[model samples]
Target: MKPVRRRIRRHFGLTAKQVAVRSKRPWYFQWGITVLYVVFGYGIAYWQFAGAEDVHQKLRQTALENQTLHTKIIQVERQLQIEQAAQTNLAQQLNKVQDENMHIKQDLVFYKNITNAKRLAK
Candidate 1:
């Protein structure tokens, strides 16, 4: 068979030595493009991190507000319970006073009836 290296060189019109030579311009240009891409990626990541931190702080403040509101509700309910108990006690005392007033009226009527009967007999 014909030599393989000679066959490949003839087909592409390039000697092996020419294919191995590297140019400086394209190599440096590729490195500059890569650096720009890295800087852009880092800037985007930093902005996203800042936004996340702001959201986290707002959530923390909202949670604290929720806890404060819950405590206020509990305290108000306790005060309402105390007021209701005082109202119940006042109602019971008013009923007892009315019962005592009814008994005093009955005793006055019985004493008047007995004194009238003794005067009629005389």
Candidate 2:
């Protein structure tokens, strides 16, 4: 293993002492980088998850509103249908009354003719 390392160092034109010194960074620098990565990664993760939660809440609220509006629309449509039926019934009643009125007017004209004829004959 030592011979292999020496051969690798020779190939890279590095002394064993220099390789050892360059391989190990200062303890503080290593710890500082680790701490920074942990803090930044946690912050990013928290922000993403929180934002997703907010979006999910908004979606739920919108869905509820949409459902409510749909129910209201259905209710309005049902009421409109009932009103239309009532209007149709009223129109039929009006037509029947008008027909009755026409018949009464014709009977009145017939009675007037009969009375006038009898008076003229007398």
Tens digits of per-residue lDDT for model 1, 4-65: 86787776755544456666688779999999999999999999998999999999999999
Top of the candidates by TM-score: 2
TM-scores of the candidates in the order shown: 0.50, 0.60
- Looking at model 1, residue 41 earns an lDDT score of 99
In the range 38-102, model 2's lDDT, one tens digit per residue, is: 99999999999989989999999999999999999999999999999999999999999999999
lDDT of candidates 1 onward, in order? 0.89, 0.94
